[model samples]
Target: MPPNSQPSPPVSPDGTTDEDAVLAVRAGKGDTAAFGALYDRYVEAVYRYVYYRVHSDTDAEDLVSDVFMRALRAIPRYEPRQAFLAWLYRIARNAVIDRARRTRIQISFEDALAHPGVDQIVEPDAGLLALADKETVRAAIARLTPLQQEVIVLRFVEGYSTSEIANLVGKREGTVRGIQFRALEMLRTLIPSREALA
Candidate 1:
């Protein structure tokens, strides 16, 4: 709101706010400050999203940079029909997929179960015990099919609704819900008992 200052937060209480839409339009028109605002707003979420998929801090950092670079170039053609976050997330998703395909990074589900940084994926507010639970949960999520993993991450970790995820992933709402359901069921089966984690 101030002259030559960083733009205010793009999301309001309801999530995607009008400010996001307005700044996105300005950024599309070559407004550097506006684009910076969008970057500041989304960089962490995008990083976390990428980190969850790649399980490497270095790769996630590189891909986050790539996602923004691509977004900056593509914003000029972006329409305001969808929430800016949705569009941005789609970009992040593609970046992850592309990186996976290009590098052929493969870690089996059992390998992820042994991965030490699983707590990194848990929400920050979770308690120590909750972190353990989340670590177990995250490992289980890694075992899911790609579609199921996307739906679960978007719905639970990133807090997108079924419809929002549907739009981002180009799946029907019912299909997203189904993926989420099956993913959760798999997680329940795969996660350790609380006592085991403790």
Candidate 2:
């Protein structure tokens, strides 16, 4: 790739985030229709994040709903931190972590493997539409620590930029880059052929 060339962005499946951002702004002012529009735009991605972290459909569903509710309340103060989705993602991540801690349980690799279908995930290098079976990728991600898994998911599946992820996770940009590099190295060891996902 040329130095001047930009990395390709994940194709938006539903083709609608700009509209959602506008709606989010309106929703902050108490527009139920606007909020509903925003909800419809991102519920799937939010659910995917929650479900991947918690590995339970029930928990993910609850967390996604709660995250949005909190977001709604917080939206009045939502300053549009990272891109709106990144901001929403940050909220979802925290809720997932808090939910896991509250249960006095950590999601283990075994648990994640037990039900891989919870998140619609793809291979590390594949087109977003050509997702690997959720279980296979979930099991591989489970092999890493939650922090590593989170970075990997954010970098790959969620397609956050290094700077964006750092802001989302409250880490330095350099730290986020280092972690992403390390996560890839670890993933290579856990699952051979780094380019296979593509």
Whole-model Cα lDDT of every candidate shown, in order: 0.70, 0.64
Candidate 1 structure quality by residue, lDDT tens digits, 41-63: 88988886776566557877999
lDDT of 1 at 89: 80
lDDT value, candidate 2, whole model: 0.64
Give one digit per residue, the lDDT tens place, for model 2 in 39-147.
8878987877666566567877899889998888887666542356757876887777687678866656666545523343324543322344565555566556667
Per-model TM-score, in order, reads: 0.73, 0.64
Pick by TM-score: which candidate is best?
Answer: 1
| TM-score, cand. 2 vs. native | 0.64
Ten residues in a row with the worst lDDT in model 1?
Answer: 120-129
